[model samples]
Target: MTAAEAARQVAKHPIQARNPIQVLGRSALSAVRMVGGVGVFAVRGTIAALSPPWFFNQLLRQFVAIGFFSLPVVGLTAIFTGAALALNIYTGGGRFNAEQVMPQIVALGITRELGPVLAALMLAGRVSAAIAAEIGAMRATEQIDAMRTLSTDPFRYLVGPRLLAGVLMLPLLTVVADTIGVSGGWLVATRVLDFSSAVYIRNTVDFLQGWDILSGLIKAAVFGFIVALMGCYHGYNAKGGARGVGRATTHAVVSSAILIFASDYLLTTFFTHAAK
Candidate 1:
């Protein structure tokens, strides 16, 4: 309304406009630092894994913990996912009088994407939280520091075996998921959707390819690493006491799940481009 007041208001508007940009810049910088931390952790863990005094027993134990114990949850998730996918696809297809394509669609959806991604998400919730809580407790109790004092390499003795187990075993879990998922689709198709089992199976087999399954396995491996890495990183760095351990567990699961989805999108994009 007045000359001086208008000038001051105009200047204030510019400063306010810069606030959001400044906040965004700081956010991006933090994200870069977090990524750098994870990358460094990966490098250290990888080196410890290869240069190991070979913790074969620890690795075997991790395999049982991560892979074997995970079967039931993964299988159930896959079966329900596949059945739901089939039903949804069949319903959508029927609107176009193409319900017969449900089998092929279900197979492709599961093997190429959903099977690995969903299984990884489930494992992230279970395994990541478990790893973080266990290691966080060790940190709180000073056991990890004690190991270091005794000339034991914590990276090798603790992180390496779990990391290696996750990288190796997730693919196996994905394979089981894929198999069960396809079977579930078959079941829904025949019993619930009123389709011939043989025809559905044949369609699924015909549409499937080596690359479809291979890509899903590869995604599973990456997701597995993400899960283990986040868990160990949060757990290893956690401070304070019980509250700190709780925070680390929550962070591990949240970060792993977010990274899984982000990496899934990138991998899917790359694979789609490569296929083309």
Candidate 2:
């Protein structure tokens, strides 16, 4: 090949090789920006929540919506999860002739991990989507803008209440979930696994510590904040039209789920070290 042609071929290959790198870099940068945006949104909402002229009624409404209405779903999920966990642990333990320990394992697993994680995951799917869709619709319809024009701070009126409610209610919901989950495990152990109910309950209570339950609640609070923050952040930034709102809702749920898992790991690690 001619020198110029060879040089051109070499340059073309470099450009082609660099294209994927550029795309990846852009993706990383976008992720960073998205995370930063959510962080800023959370900070703003927190500040608004703590400021004067608080909206107690709005906060109360959100508390009921997020906590009270969410009970059925959370409770059902927790119970089912607990029963399944007990069955699995019993089966696994039977293989090693350790079936009697299933009660303690079930209790520990539920309180230290599954209760907060599963409850948060369920809430992320239900609550995050709802918040995102509502706020996205408001943004699409320019109602948020209208509120600003009427001297209403959208952050305080909209985002703050949701954030506060999530932080407060998720722990409560998780506690209910933990109780249901433990009870379900006990029921399954007693009925299906032929375990003594009194023995199971006694073992569970004996094996579980206050810190184990407290750690789960703490994790729930963080997950709750993540869910609400993701919902509000995506909804607030939604653009385009109906399509944009739909995208925001999808993003909110997906992001909240991911953050829940990620934060769960971090919190679990922290708690483990703290226990040490």
Candidate 3:
């Protein structure tokens, strides 16, 4: 028997038979119900987004809060990542006396992969948790019900703005990250590693293909969408009290991170093939 079966048997009522079949059937039904509920919500959200009557103010707030507030953290990560990438490349390439490739490699890696991926993960943790907690708390306090009672559509006010914020802010944040990352590599190559700054920058420019940068930015937008969607989805559905809110927060981060990595691979494939 599975561990779940054994646990069920142990918790079985004294007068009832320990029926694993019933347990399995109930569990299967629960799974199906959950899947159906998710489909409903996804459809509902999509339809709502397509509707012409929208909440512009809330959308603007989401953009400013998520994109503007996220700048400092994203910038810091990119700068450090760029510097460290340069050092690592210099060390590895020096084995073949090819340390000159640091600038181009760092630039490519940061813009095409690390910048968007890392920024999304970071924002996932920060933004997702905050959204889940705030929404969950409001839910626990019955504010959602209050909105419904007032004839307000919660999805348009809450989910739409957040979704728009993520889509918009992510690309902007990526630009900042990309620029900062290249500058970081410049610093390391010129001052710390004693390479000529002009040579590094020029080579980086010459080696860069448009697709490399474009692919990463596209991934950022997708990642941002996933992160915000998961956050709002989990938050809107959050159950119970404080404990449920915590669980929703955890699920948002975990789900968003997985989707980001998965989307990155697909985006990479598209860019690679297009370039060919």
Candidate 4:
């Protein structure tokens, strides 16, 4: 109400306005630094993976953990997704009396996009979290340091195996997903939609091209690398203790999912242009 009070309030309002700008600047810098850190970590991990003195035992274990154990969930996701896609496509097609396109559309959708993306998302939740927690726990308990004391490179022994396993396993998993998803569509179309099973199978096989399947597999491999990279990056740098490990696990999953979607879009665009 007083002139002095009003002047003070006016001055404080400018400072308050500047505070948000400062916060925004800090956040942007932090994001840039985080991205740079992850990129450097990825390069180091790749080098460790490619270098000699490889650990086949660790690699084999990761293959089983990342690939074999992941089949059930991926299969379930694929089958249900395919069936749902078929239903939606058929319903939409009915509007224009084009329902017969269900088989071709379902196959194309599963092989081109849904199969690889869903499989990666599932692994991002399951495998990425597991990897981050495991490595974070090792870091928390100083076991990673212990490995260093023994002259064992933690990146070579731990990160490399997991990274290689992820890159190799995801494509295999995507293939299974594609097969199961198409089968699901076929099942739904035949049993529920009264489509002829033989015709549906024939149409799907005829309509799908090699490039469609190959592109999905390529996306799977890239997604696998992203999942493993995020997990290792967060876990390797985790601080504090139990709380840090939990935070790393959460970050790993969130980052992996975001990167998967973003990269999927990029890869899809590249493949589309290339195909043309």
Candidate 5:
């Protein structure tokens, strides 16, 4: 191409100084709408979940699947995380002769936040993507339509169980994570950090209160609901064929993970204000 033509083509795609501002506005608008939609969907689904026979069945199945089945993996993750956290904190605090804080800090930090939040994220990645892909495939292949023809409400049949399971199980998994994590911390503190088991346990118990555990459980519940909703929403709405289902599954995981962090900040802010 001639120099003039090249220059004109580049000009067509020029980076305007106002480009960032326009992009920001568009992003803000999209986010607002997205949040509104998700909230509406969640509320409606929750209403349906609380109605009659469907609710009880979903609740039981979910409780078993989410709380009982997730125990092993959650426990394993928590244990290692707690041990690592104790070691790191001890090493860092040693500089200021504050190694005494390790046990208590580790317990409070894990029980109050990390244990529940991380466990939820892990479960979201595992469960949300799976649900999304499954639902997306069903939708793509007209299986969902067949369910309607058979007089089944797809939301009640498919989304309800998974949603209930996630919301109910997360808090249970979180409790498991907290317990295992604290135990791990205890092991490290006594064996590697040269702290006495009695001192470690005492500090851990003394520093952690009812509010801390309650907060963690609440966060787990929110995380669980978000993960399930995101998965179901994406999968149920998936387009195209197998490729589309895969893409939806990926989107569900990414979106669910991002939402977890964003919600964590909001939940922390609320907890901080409440404590104040």
Candidate 6:
């Protein structure tokens, strides 16, 4: 082939080949950029939360929305999860003739893993989506712009309260979830599994350590922050009017759920090593 033709053929071949290495490199860069953007957003949010002109009214309203309104769903999820856990544990332990260990295992599992994770997942679905939808709608409608025109910082007025409330309230909700979950396990153990109520309670109480509960609370706090952060980030950056708001709502929930699980694994690993 002539030099010009050979050059054009080489260019076409590269385009057609679709190099795996190049594809992977592009994906990795995109992921890094996304993570960096999220980090910057988180820093700005934290600064806004700490600055003056605190809005206690907004914070109180968020408390009711994130903590109180979330109670029924969180509680229901915890109870059913605990019941299923108990039944499963009983069945598995029965194979080894160790069914008596159900109470202790149930308590440990709930407090250390299930309680905070389940509660946070529920909040991500309910509270995170709500926050994103609200803020995204405000963005789509230009209400955020109007607030800025009125000399109001949207971060301070909008993002700060939800962040504070989520960080503070989720641990409390997780506490309630832990209680309800343990109670459910107890109910199943005593009623369905035919375990003695008093002995089961005693085993659970005796086996559950302070660190187990504390670790779960710590996880809850982190998950809470993640939920709020994801919601605010998506909502604040949303565009495309109504469609943008809808997309933000969905992203908030999905990202919060994914981050919750990811962070839970990290925290669990940290706690495990620390205990060791």
Of 1 and 5, the candidate ranking higher by TM-score:
1
- Higher-scoring candidate on TM-score, 1 or 4: 4
Report the C-alpha displacement of residue 76, candidate 5, in angstroms: 1.7
Candidate 3 C-alpha lDDT tens digits along 1-276? 996785465446423534777666556765687668766766676566657568888877788789988989999999999999999999999999989888989989998999999889889989987887778887888999999888888877787778778877898899899999989989988999998877988999999988778888888988888888888888889999999999989988998898899999988888788878
Top model number, lDDT: 4
TM-score of 5: 0.86
Candidate 2 ranges with C-alpha deviation above 4 Å: 1-18
The regions of model 3 sitting more than 4 angstroms off are: 1-39
| Residue 251 in candidate 4, Cα distance off native in Å | 0.4
In order, candidate lDDTs are: 0.90, 0.90, 0.84, 0.93, 0.84, 0.91
Q: What stretches of model 6 exceed 4 Å from their correct place?
A: 1-26
- Look at candidate 5 and tell me the lDDT of residue 223: 95
* Candidate 6 Cα deviation (angstroms), residue 24: 4.5
Q: How far in Å is the alpha carbon of 218 misplaced in model 2?
A: 0.3
Q: Which stretches of candidate 5 lie over 4 Å from their true place?
A: 1-33, 55-61
- Residues 133-180, model 1: lDDT tens digits: 999999999999999999989999889998998888889999999999
Please give, for residues 94-145, the per-residue lDDT of candidate 4 as tens digits.
9999999999999999999999999999999999999999999999999999
Q: What is the TM-score of each candidate against the true structure?
A: 0.90, 0.92, 0.87, 0.93, 0.86, 0.91
The sequence of per-residue lDDT tens digits that candidate 5 reaches over residues 1-276 is 975564454446545424675456555655787789778778766765666448466567667766676777788889999999999999999899999988888988998888988898888878888889889999999999999999878877777777878887898889889999999999988888788888888888888889999999999999999999999888988999999999999999999999999999999999999999
**Model 5, position 40: C-alpha lDDT score:** 79
| Residue pairs with backbone atoms closer than 3 Å in model 3 (clashes) | none
Worst 10 residues of 3 by lDDT: 9-18
True-vs-predicted CA distance for residue 34, candidate 3, Å: 4.9
Candidate 6: Cα lDDT at 253: 99
